[model samples]
Target: MAMFVHLTAAANTPRIRRAGIRADSRGQGGVRGVYCFPVLPSYTLTHQWLRELARFGPKGALSAVHVRLADAQEVLVGHYRDRAKDAQQWLTAAEAVARVAAQPDPRGWEVVVPRAIGAREVHRIRAVPQVAGWRYLPGAHGTRPCTCVGCRIRGEYGGRRLRERHPHPLDGPPPPVPVLLARIEAAGDPGDQAALLDALHWFGLRRRGPVDRLARLAAHPDPAVRRELVWAVQGWSTPGVAELLDPLAEDPHPDVREAVADVRELMDEQES
Candidate 1:
């Protein structure tokens, strides 16, 4: 996902365009500074929506939230000419809503919305298969409620109270390390490949064998895959992991080089 902030001349002052809205900032030392709002890709926006839902109970009406989100998206589409950018804004808005609905709070914090309206929008978003790696909702499966002490305490408050609880893990065991490794190897799509690498990092590989398997991807054709490979190597302290990373220090891509530097710095910190 690429973020673009456009600066244009307007009358005597410079106007900054971000998220499709223009704002004026005071000139400093005869130079006008451009104000830029961080442009969040659809994936990031969906993640943010999940975080917001987890923190605050979804009390507002769905229509109201939809309108607000739509306005933000319209502004983005207007400013950015890229069709992908426009698609991302719409997809992010819809996916975020669907994720919130799927993970309804049992404690009644989940906002009630017209099922038809919400479902219609979700269906529309899902119909477009162009967006790769679009999952309906993450962590939606499993029936077992969290038995953690925090969950237990939060359960006592009922619908009236809004107490924050750490999200309970789902009931099922995580996918085996080998399965994830194979998925990473088989993934042909850049986005899917990157995501799998990230998941592998999160799941962690205890054995040196899996790390060795992952390190081989450092020579992958795509820079993104190489970068993720570099990231995955940071956690492993195996004997030849340094050997795997050393060649990457001279990688043509700045991002790959930076990742190698980060790993080296972290290794230094650990050794010291």
Candidate 2:
């Protein structure tokens, strides 16, 4: 039998100990499966989702349910995005282990067993660190809190109030970056425009972004808005990022100028 680890709420330990893990509708079209990670040599990688999955539960501990599956058992394995896109592939239990082991960073990867796991297949349940991997995304803490509806899932354990405390400009279909930037430029309230400007940073964080428009914010009337503007362009690695930050470096307000220096220093550390 192959070994795997299923991360579940510590509250469900008794139920799992009694009836084993029953496959629920964790996939598309109500497809039920026991979702788990392969028990690899690296314990951290094996239970990578321990922290991420814990976000769905109340303020409670999470337990790792060790599972022993037959090598012949059929399973579905792919990156979590593949499961999201309904592009999962069928593989033997052993094959899933091999597939996951080959990946350099398998944080968003998954293995789905399409059937229930009997209690006998349960090897043991272990207590793991509540804080294991990252939440939202890797290095998410480096950026400001995101208020987009999609980023803030309903019923998540913590941070609901904090995430919702800010205005969610992305409650629905958001306009393109250029369109939204135009709106922010024309928007009446400088405060609201600053808030929107902050949100725009995450749009193309690691991609080429609209830096030309962002560069113009160096001349905003309010120092606070210009300060926020400094943060808004901090994450872009685009060619024009330096050009945009150049003007902010000479900003009239010390705070805005300071923010530009901080962003450059922080981004330099990140890039290095």
Candidate 3:
């Protein structure tokens, strides 16, 4: 599914002129930088560029392409400085930036510059996507992670500014527990089910549901299912949950015992 977004011009930027220029470039529409949110659980980076295309009209017909730079384009150095020798990371970052710069559209442009950089350190250039051949330059800038979740995970490239990408998880956010649980129950792929369950547990979303649903999970036959149920019940301490939790606490699986211990601590706290 496409990531939803609101794309707009960076104040006072003129809509491309239409007169002699082709009507397509005449500013009937605009271009903008696509934001990518990788931290959110979907692991699907929000396709800001596609969203921009949707908003600005067809890439060939749009008039102005607005790029949100001041906030999103400065984190390329730290992500690469130390890991220069790591080919995979370097290549991934390189490819993402290249893909962004090489987009085929005349109505848009990408505004890229270094953050915390002084005028003397580098020549700051804004590469409109249609202009072609744009790249980043390096310099001393107090860089931060890209504010947009996708950029944070995917990283950006500014001409010569080769920075490192952050190591945050790519999944943006977990689907609501009920949603994930239902998918797990319906999914034929064990890996998919396990991945969802693990995500639910990792994000600490387990507390939002009923202990009984989880207790019933303990006997699900599939060891993986039983294992995840253990995590789901790990911290449950609702008053009537003891009956549901006690058996799993002594279940043959070490995972079950560990979950029981975890829940016991919750019960102990409630008693205190």
TM-scores vs. true structure, each candidate: 0.35, 0.57, 0.31
TM-score, prediction 2: 0.57
Q: Please state the error at residue 43 of candidate 3 in Å.
A: 47
Q: In candidate 1, which residue ranges exceed 4 Å CA deviation?
A: 1-165, 168-174, 188-195, 203-209
Top-TM-score candidate index: 2
Point out the worst 10-residue segment of candidate 1 by lDDT.
Answer: 106-115
| Better TM-score candidate (2, 3) | 2
Q: How accurate is candidate 2 locally (lDDT)?
A: 0.73
lDDT of 3 at 25: 17
Segments in model 2 whose C-alpha atoms lie over 4 Å from true places: 83-86, 138-141, 153-167, 171-272
Query: Residue 141 in model 2: shift from native, Å?
Result: 4.6
Q: What is the per-residue lDDT of model 3 for residues 66-164, given as tens digits with 9 covering 90 to 100?
A: 222222233221221233333212123233344434544312222212222222222222223332221121221355534233232122224113222
Deviation from native of the Cα of residue 149 in model 2, angstroms: 1.3
81: Cα error in model 2, Å: 1.2
In the range 147-239, model 2's lDDT, one tens digit per residue, is 675476545545566655666765433456676666666664443654565456454332456777666556768887777766756766677
What TM-score number comes out for model 3? 0.31
**Candidates sorted by TM-score, best first:** 2, 1, 3
Clashing pairs in 1: none
